[model samples]
Target: MSERKPRKDAARNRAAVLAAADELFARRTSPEDEVTMADIAAAAGVGKGTLFRAFGDRTGLIHALYEARVEPIRNAVEEGPPPLGPATPPLQRLPALLDAILCFKLDNRHLALALEGTGSDSPYQAGHYDRWHALLQAVLEQIPGLTDSDFTAHVLLAATRADLVEHLVGQRRLPPEGLRAQLASFTTKVLGSPALPGSPAEQIHS
Candidate 1:
């Protein structure tokens, strides 16, 4: 019972830490680089020691927060229904998948920036990137006449990169819906088809 109590406390602490970090990143006006583990600990009302023990470092904390935020999208893509699920047609699903990713980056602008900016490791080498690439490549493979699924996947995913999203939204001041329309058109060209009908991007505003 004592051991179970510590485990429960640990889970609770982890949840509190993630929640605090999410709030901090969402609210920050400065670069995410300035948000430290110490800041998260203070905001969570936990000691710095506890925060460090739970997440190891700032990068890990950011990664965890990103994963938590993306969990719903992940589930929808993996198992939920059409336009995102495994059961959808590749032609339609491809645009939906990319649209979902773009929307995620747009919504969590700061958090996405933090994850891509963290550490020295190449963003392309990250586990999340690999999973997205693999899934995209697999979908592309299903479409007829689409060769080089690997390179195509990279290209499509590149369009949704956090920095690019920031540039278009922040620097260019392009509205989110406008960006989505552009992406849909770009994706349509890549797929060698007319603009995809019933795109999941519509659900964003609905």
Candidate 2:
């Protein structure tokens, strides 16, 4: 027998269930909270069996939620900015990358908070940090009069991370613009000079 397509109502129900689960998981408190399949099914107005059939289990559902939320940020960083080229000055590209990074964090604050609450070990976290560190290091390496220990680039990247920004703005009440300027200053200092004079990529550090 040919497989039957799901009825329109069934499709709607599935969508509703996923949406509900997303909301709950996004706001779930404590890893110990019992966010059972039943809770998600009820929230979505679907049957428990439907929920199970749609998503293998709670972990699968959580993973789906995270992927749905975070994919855009990853894409923006990897592709949205100007292409990384030898001719392009890191200083100019750096600001664009920073702007994109900040926008991602601000847009996904709630999801970020949820992820932090889970305390899960994610390769994405390490990979993302490594990528940022690498990019900054590459920029520094291209500049003159600014060679240092390998750890310096990592330290600068870590200092200017999204989590630190969230803490500074959300918890410490620093204006976002002010924080951005301060971070730019710190980054420039860490990198030594923006660019060499007469170089198209050169930028003033101050």
lDDT digits (tens) for residues 68-178 of candidate 2: 766765565455534233345665555444544554455554445444334355423543556666766676666666667357666665555546666887678888667
lDDT of 2: 0.58
Compose the digit string of candidate 1's lDDT tens values, residues 1-206. 87999999999999999999999888866453478888899999999999888888888888899999999999999998887899988888899999999999999988888888774656785668889999999999999998999999999999999889988897789999899888888999988987655656874334
| Candidate that scores best on TM-score | 1
Q: How does each model score on TM-score?
A: 0.94, 0.57
lDDT of 1 at 178: 92
Clashing pairs in 1: none
True-structure Cα RMSD, model 2: 6.5
Measured by TM-score, how close is model 1 to the native structure? 0.94
Clash count, candidate 1: 0
Stretches of candidate 2 above 4 Å error?
1-43, 46-63, 70-73, 81-88, 117-127, 134-150, 160-163, 194-206
lDDT of each: 0.87, 0.58
